[model samples]
Target chain A: MTTRILTPEELALLSLVQDELVPSYGDLPPAGTLGAALTVDAYLAEQPRLRRPVLTTLRAIEVRAGKAPFAELDAGRRVEVLRKVENADPESFSELVKQTYNAYYTRPDIQASLGIDNPPQPLGFELPAFDESRLSRVRAMGKLWRDD
Target chain B: MAAPELDSDVLIVGSGASGAAAAWSLSRGGLRVTCLEQGRWVDPSEYAHSRPDYELARQTSFAKDPNVRGWAADYPINNSGTPIYPLMVNAVGGSTVHWSGHFPRMRPSDFRVRTLDGVADDWPFTYWDLEPYYDLNDSMVGVSGLAGDPANPPRSPRQTPPLAFDAGCEAYLRGLENLGWHWWPCDNALISEPFGENRSPCNCCGPCDIGCPIGAMSSAHVTYWPKALAQGVQLITHARVEQITVDHAGQATGALYYDDHGVRRSHTAGVVVMAANGVGTPRLLLNSTSARFPNGLANNSGVVGAYLMFHPVAFVSGVFEEVVNGQRGPIGGLMNCQEFYETDLARGFVRGFELQLSRSVGPLSVANGGILGHPVPWGSEHHEALRSRYAHTMTTSVMLEDLPEPENRVTLDPELTDAHGIPAPRVEYRAGENTQRMLEFSIARARELFEAAGAVEILVDPLVQESGWHLMGTCRMGDDPERSVINGWGQAHECSNLFVIDGSTFTTSAAVNPTSTIQAVALRCADWLGRNYRDVAA
Candidate 1:
């Protein structure tokens, strides 16, 4: 609940961007629905060097949307604004996209939607029994290198 | 300030794979052995693979990079000039705790690389000399492998059965068969069935590199250290050894170390064994300057920190139609194809490489950035790719043989120092032409294997410099004192009672993982020491 890393304005801009990156689609919730923007805030809180770059990008997007907050912009206008910002500072925009995707996709709910068990541990999935006959041919290849 | 001193019959400077093996052998042979580990034991409860926040846990605690993990006992490495940033762990089991448990023995041809290929220096002894010790170490550590691997020489029976093959390995095996290439189930240092009293069968938790919680994978902490401790081998944790104290006769008398409480202490012993790994061993030796040996202890030839070798790796990933469940089995590759492991004059490279078919990627790994030149797509395409590639991707690592180069070495940094105020180890390395050629050839072969397996999409990673896992050849072994630091028996040539029993004594790195050979050599060194105990104690 700590809002020290991201201000209300920055969080609102990030949420709008997160939704566009991963919109809700047929049983899968959008990035904003999973609270990924808050996760980004928490992640950047530990990495002080990355905090300014992310906030500056958000502020730029808001300003480019005609003096209006990014969240209040039309969906088409939001996409157009993001495209412009991406062209200007591609590396920063790419970093933002990566962080948003990572935070959204790693959530347990998102994992369930993707048919993946979140940690893949404690009760690990079992594989099909080994078919010995499949390896018979490779086993027959026999000593291809010079051992002596 | 005056330092407190302790005494032991035999003192080992590390508690890693080689150090633990030596401790087991020497203590069982009736010597009072003591091992000094710079890091503390890993808490089993803190092993976080079972939790939902596993990726976060890995970044905070279990990362391979020392600077990223930021453990207290971890030392800094100056990687400015090195091709690869050094990857190592500093716990009781050392890097073994985070290893993938790929245990392949060096071939007989590897021992005579100089005579056969006329490229690198040969080992002082042959593979036959260490074969028995390799079998012994395998039995001790419980290797899960088949008996007749056509790629290797005939060996004794394995302690356990081979790990069950997954769909990815099956496809790779079929592909290798189609290509008429030599392939075999990897000799893994993991228990497939219950063996030892404390050990259990692998449950396939898929995080073997992050310290197995169930004592299934044969890390030194769960395998050798327990037996060594039972034999009364004393292990002193959080002891950062700075230098080896030598006598006026150039004999190793003891070691100066900093304890957990930041107190400078000394441990005197009749014999001192340096099992502090390739980087740490050389750093300690170069720092241990004395009046008789002003350059460094047992470094009379100035080759103590030279000839560093690490396997230059190339990666390839293939996307299959079937759901292979890439995150189900062991973290390492399942099958090993060494079709080009030997020297062939037809190829540009003197020595060749090994291809390990790995299937251990997870959804998060794919999401972060798909490995092996397959960048994860963004926007709408991202979800579709993740759904398709998360369980369908198969990867291979082309482990190339790197020859001994004197310039590729670990030296002490002039400016940087560790928490204990000792000079940090600085690595300087670059891939030679031979390695580069081998990587090129191996990557092409890997792509062919993927194609033969009917992969839908094949992604090739030209070279990965960060795959510097096998640290070797910093304190090389040979017959002559002028050429090597240690002899065939791992005994220091310049100093009689000084010994080095680690990957640091490797003369030439083979095209495979080095842990099995490291443990085997340590066991051989211990046997030699036991036989010559009377001479060494004098």
Candidate 2:
């Protein structure tokens, strides 16, 4: 609910990593295009406990890339750095991955494109009513359990 | 911090499935009833399913794990070194607030586990003793199912028709038919038709576990609590129970709990019922120590925190080549196969597993790898992987019936404490040899079912953390007062006025969802109390 929990520098670094994580695919833009970094930053403000670990992860990845803030690193070099960070501290890295994906995919436009009517409430989907015919074969073999 | 005493004839702690049922029955029977729930009431409008950030909300606000969500009402549970982390909510409806409403009654043989399978203690009462209660609870909860399946005993017709099967469930049903195995459209605690004034009919919203805003799912708040409140049952919300106080005779007087304003208060009731599920019940019992009962109230049998059981689940997801909508219908299960439900000596295990069909996957779940434990790879293959697994995958929670072991238990953590400084429950559990073997056997069989359904590829995460929803056997019930903590009627062996009407009193953990059975047991206990409160109270 708070505005701009992350610094511009931090947001820049996070967007680069988010882009690297999901990249771009066809007409669907990458995670960065869908504002994953901003969403994650806003979420971190809500869940204050997660903010430190996420920032620590970003700084660690920056250190791993050497002389670069991980944002300036080439695509090839960035992948190497991310893999190394993932191996070194899996919990933080995995949490970052989880949050990134969560932010990217739950966006209304993304869900709409994925054939989901957004906000699956008030009005929901429909399917066939329960048909008794489906149980014809199984019911034919009467009563498998021995007890009443 | 002591506050004024409140008036009540019966005080029940925890307003989950069992607690709600007990409240309704006891209050209807004309007894003064009051329930203390640690968490506040949740309005249907606040449910995550209605928001665009629904999946993210599941990780944060609506998380099943208390440690992850870290709300004020929740007490920290130390689940260190346990493969299956316990998942529960502390709100008015308790865990049922975010439940799948997958209602499966324990079979007749489940009660006589020791006599038939030659392991674990048999329940003091038989399935026949509890059958009427089960039928009553089913009617009250408005269970949706088809009768005469032949896998279990014939029963009264279900209240409503079975939930509609999605494409993924239909595919699984086809697999069962192809293999000539026994299968049934699952019984769910869901209202297919509009039964309650508050709840809407099922529209197959596909996110019942995310907290149903429409109230089609039979959560206790919507189903039992409404009637219980209407019948003049006084339910106290945000009342975190700290200890179960006792009289000089070691008989139950009432409970001392921290009220909403963090003020200590005492409520005196003639009878006290511990309806705070398996883990929560034991934690409270162990934390409550007094001069009359050194080891803890009603814990003289030394089985107060023993024989803890969790149906260790092995999650298997199948990716089919054919079109299947995994994101429609009830996500918990539309079909469940009990082919290996009965214990066969040849299977190399004393107990078996029930393969529950679940195919609901959201975009966020798919991107984050869901329960299958394989995050869709990033970069070039990300979109393709997402599309392939989105609606085309179906899952089965291979629920293994973990036999009760004395070593597997819930103990009070000396170092860890809740906000009120009450000791937190430390769970010490490892899947025993029997459960491990059963998993190996059941996982292989589950693969066959998926294969028959034309799954191009299959994924298995042998054990998932969120599968620890079924908590039982921390305070066992039996005929022998020396062996069990509670008696057949769920009355504490040492304390006549104290009753345990939750999964904690289960003698054995059956290989099915225990909500239906838990409520049935609660109903039976409340019915007994209503008819004989004077005798029991004396």
- The parts of candidate 2 lying over 4 Å away from their true place are A1-3, B1-6
Clashes of 2: 1
TM-score of chain B of each: 0.97, 0.98
In Å, what is the interface RMSD of model 1? 2.2
Among residues 3 or more apart in sequence or in different chains, the pairs in candidate 1 whose N, CA or C atoms overlap within 3 Å are none
Candidate 2: residue B174 lDDT (0-100): 72
Candidate 1 chain A vs. true chain A: TM-score?
0.86
CA lDDT of each prediction against the hidden true structure: 0.84, 0.86
Best candidate according to DockQ: 2
Off by over 4 Å in 1: A46-69, A72-98, A145-147, B1-6, B371-374
Q: Give the per-residue lDDT of model 1 (tens digit) for A20-117.
A: 87777787777876788999998798767567678778877877888777777887887889889888987787778767866876687777776766
Weakest lDDT window of 10 consecutive positions for candidate 1 chain A: A125-134
Worst 10 residues of 2 chain A by lDDT: A1-10
In terms of docking quality, model 1 is medium
Enumerate residue pairs that collide in model 2: A143-B150
